[model samples]
Target: MSDTAIRVTGRCRCEKNPVRFEYTKVPAEVHYCLCTDCTDISGGAMALIAVVERSTFRITQGESKIHNYDTKPTCHRRFCSECGCHMFLYVDAFPEHLLIHVPTLDRGQDIGAKPDRYVFVNSKLAWLTLPDDGLPRHQGWANSGAPVEV
Candidate 1:
């Protein structure tokens, strides 16, 4: 991947509001999640998240419309309340960073980099079909990876 930092911009489903963010550095990790909670909340088969430093992201506009939901003790999801668009997530493990949903970002950005692994495959719906490519698949969080530090 090019070392050049990528700029991503997005807005709440309402065109009136906009959010801008840039990654000062490449994300430490990026992946697709097939967990039931993600599917249920986003109404999608999977969610693509880019792990980035909290400081690298900002709400350039409409901060008041940002809403949060603590679905679990450690999982906190954020969305645009005005149009009900799930945008990002914050987990207790990575208090200093935010996970941005790739789809929520501006279109034409190169986020197609396939996920390095599949998470929560055990709960994945039977009707869904993940590609045969040999990406590491996990039942839940990958404990083998280094802990995210603040």
Candidate 2:
């Protein structure tokens, strides 16, 4: 990946937001989460997340359209009130990081990083079969490249 600074743009489905933002650098980590907290919130089978520094994320547009929901207690998911699509989340458990949903990025934008691991696999849907991508699998999150033993 290029060491040059890369800015990423993300938005909701309303087509009213360009929610421009910068990532200073590439993401610290990326992964697929099968946790119910993620799936249930996004209404998806799983979530592809990029853990980025909070200092690097900036909201450039449609600020008023963004709304926050305290999915649990300290977990906050921010979405567009119009389209109800989640763009990013702030987890108190990992305060320094903003977990961004990769799909929100502008079309054809290079992510510069790929999912390095699969997490919360223990809770993964029974019908889903993981590919042999050679990445580590974790039953839970260790917040690093390391996998947790469930």
Candidate 3:
């Protein structure tokens, strides 16, 4: 089935003024990001990102509670101002897409896509170990770089 036939919903961490969002199309790509910027801001060793087309994604609620933090000149990360949860972001390099944090999806909702690879593995934390899932590991962005030996 076409990914556009599926829909998924998500919300931010705020109890009273949650920032809600939904995407009707399947993501163009999904992967694990180990870039320091993503890992540092999210306080995790890695980040699961769903690259959804901007035209198919929308904020459904709490628009007034949304805030933008420019993690870099080319990256604008959006979060819920009330609860400070970073749920999505826009990258200048991928103007047509919005990168959604996978964990923001409502529990049990089919994410509509599976992570195909791990990117920025060269920046991965030393204490963390990659899983044996067999996904390709890239030293940088998946599109511009070659897979690295795991």
Candidate 4:
């Protein structure tokens, strides 16, 4: 991972409100999630999430427009109420940070790197098959990597 930091900015689908997230430090990790829940929420096959500290994320405007859905007791997904754009998710396990979707960031902001592995492959639809290059595949979340400290 590079030591350099990059600024990431995003907004709702309508672009009415904007949020800025400064990745002051390179992410400890990044990954693609193919879980059913992720796919259902994103309306896509997978979700690209970048684990970032809460301190680095800021809602520059339209804070009230951000709505949250507590899917589980420990998991909360946030989105723009006006545009209904799913931007980030906050988990009780990592209360001090935000998991921002990489695709939501500004077009030019380099997302550091792509996911090195896939998680929740067991729940992935049978129609979808990832490349057989042999990256680590996990039935659920990967616990072998550095744990995110809350």
Q: What's the TM-score of each model vs. the native?
A: 0.83, 0.88, 0.96, 0.83
Question: Candidate 4: TM-score?
Answer: 0.83
lDDT of 4: 0.74
Which candidate wins on TM-score?
A: 3
Clashes by residue pair, model 3: none
lDDT of each: 0.73, 0.81, 0.92, 0.74
Looking at candidate 4, the ten consecutive residues that score lowest on lDDT are: 141-150
The regions of model 1 sitting more than 4 angstroms off are 1-4, 111-114, 144-150
The local distance difference test score of model 2 is 0.81
lDDT per residue (tens digit) for residues 2-87 in model 2: 57468777777775454555576678889899989999888888899998889878887788888899989988999888888889
Model 4, residue 88: displacement in angstroms? Answer: 0.2
What is the C-alpha lDDT profile of model 1 across 95-126, one tens digit per residue?
88888887887787665344677766777788
| Model 2 poorest ten-residue lDDT run | 141-150
Q: What is the lDDT of residue 133 in candidate 2?
A: 79
Order of the predicted models by TM-score, top scorer first: 3, 2, 4, 1
